[model samples]
Target: MALYEFRCRECGSTFEVDRPMQRSSDPADCPDGHSDTVKLLSTVGLGGRARTATRPVRPPSPFSGGGPPPMGGGGGGCCGGGGCG
Candidate 1:
C-alpha cells in the first residue's frame, strides 16, 4: 500500500490516504464529505521520495572503520560512529 495526497477542490482541503497505485487517479470523496472533489496536480513532501521508483539510497555506513560486526553478535561501539557508553 502507498500513501497518496489529495486536494479537494470543493472544500479546498488537502488530505492523505493509503491506497493502491491504481486508486491514485480514481475519484475519491473528500474527507470533508464533499463529492465534487477532484485530485489536484501537486508535489508531495520529502521530494516525493516515498513514491520514487528507485530503491532508497542510504547514507554512507558509519562502520567504515571496518565491516559490520557479525550479525547478532554483541558490539560495543555506537553505530553512528560516536563513542558508545
Candidate 2:
C-alpha cells in the first residue's frame, strides 16, 4: 500500500489517502465530498542515508577527552561555542 496527499481545489482542503500502489493515481474526494482535487507532491523518506544538513555524524574529538563532541562551525557565533549544537 502507498500513501498519497491531495489538495482540494474547490474547497482548498488537504487530505491523505492510504490505498494500493496500483490505484494511487486514482482521483480522490475531499472530506467535504469535493471532487475538484489535485494530487500534491509529497516528500518521501526512504529510511536510509545519513542527513548531513542539520545533524551530521562525525568522529569524537580527541581534545574534549570523552566529553561532548566538537562543534562544527567557523568559530563565529552560536554554533561556534557549541551552544546551538
* Top candidate when judged by TM-score against the true structure: 2
The TM-scores, one per candidate, come to 0.44, 0.53
Cα lDDT tens digits for candidate 2, 1-85 = 8889999999998999999989978999999999999998876734566667787668655543454545663333444453564
Model 2 stretches astray by more than 4 angstroms: 45-85
| Candidate 1 lDDT score relative to the true structure | 0.66
RMSD of each: 12.5, 11.4
**How much does candidate 1 score in TM-score?**
0.44
Name the TM-score of candidate 2. Answer: 0.53
lDDT of 1 by residue, 8-73 (tens): 877799887788877778777788787776665656534735555677866545455455654566
lDDT accuracy of residue 11 in candidate 2: 90
